[model samples]
Target: GAGVSQSPRYKVAKRGQDVALRCDPISGHVSLFWYQQALGQGPEFLTYFQNEAQLDKSGLPSDRFFAERPEGSVSTLKIQRTQQEDSAVYLCASSTDRGSVADTQYFGPGTRLTVL
Candidate 1:
């Protein structure tokens, strides 16, 4: 029953502040993703990582957004110079890659960030 979990379920940040969100994925999952969900829109992919390598990051909004999985288990999303538009729910999802055509992703509760 491995599950993904995020920290600081809620966060408040100043307009120009920097914030770091953490995500702990299911143990042994090789694929990880970071998503951002706005007020009314569905979750948008932000980044993806396979093991410790960042395979795709084209979905990231700006250079201010960054995500990393150093040891391939725990990932961190860092936002610098946060803006009001940056306020959203950050979600973490992970899936296993065991020679399967399709892997089901398990998502975390998400960390809601508010930039005032």
Candidate 2:
């Protein structure tokens, strides 16, 4: 892929169900980030990874949310015990910079997860 790509572009999950979202970043990008965007609101940072090491996860809303970037290029965001509040678009982005705060990120189309 020339840019970031995400799997399961759209997902519908019943309450209590678990879901995993996949993200494949551009080759050689060293920084990856996960964000959650609610209706009419901007994306909120969820986590960040530099290479295969998770450097920040303080923005994750709860323990039910987890993200990993093993081997550095591919990442996954998992939400366990889904709730209605979890309904939102999960976005994955990558940057060529080494996890710098000012890095310009290229985003994927995102996976829209709807919880019922």
Candidate 3:
């Protein structure tokens, strides 16, 4: 079965640098979510998208961070003016909206970002 996957599994950046992380979800999944996990901390929800519409984004830490789902299947998270504290694992999870499908989310291998 196909699953979610991320790109550039690792990243290094200087403070104030900008970076983009990509997530490719399983085809036909109707709901998508983004989460951030800091070192030694549980993942924190960042945003949620249903189809191509952004249903929730209250968890975004700052205006400098942004996410998009222009095609409903692939999404990107962008962080600008990055600080060392911004280092974390960015995770993408997706679930289907069909009946009989358990509301279980399949998570992607996260993209690790480090700001120096």
> Model 2, 104: alpha-carbon shift in Å?
1.1
Query: What C-alpha root-mean-square deviation, in Å, does candidate 1 show against the real structure?
Result: 0.9
> Could you tell me how far off, in angstroms, the CA of residue 19 lies in candidate 1 after the best superposition?
0.3
Task: Please give the lDDT score for candidate 1.
Answer: 0.95
Instruction: Assess every candidate by TM-score.
Output: 0.96, 0.95, 0.94
Model 2: ten consecutive residues of lowest lDDT: 95-104
Worst 10 residues of 3 by lDDT: 95-104
> Taking the tens digit of each residue's C-alpha lDDT, what string does model 2 give over 1-55?
5999999999999999999999999999999999999999999999999899999
Query: What C-alpha lDDT, on a 0 to 100 scale, does residue 46 get in candidate 1?
Result: 94
Query: Taking the candidates one at a time, how many backbone clashes does each contain?
Result: 0, 0, 0
TM-score top scorer? 1
- Which regions in candidate 1 have their CA more than 4 angstroms from the true location? none
Ranking by TM-score: 1, 2, 3
Residue 74's lDDT in candidate 3: 93
* Best-first order by lDDT: 1, 2, 3
Q: Model 3: per-residue lDDT, tens digit, 23-68?
A: 9999999999999999899899999998899999999999999999
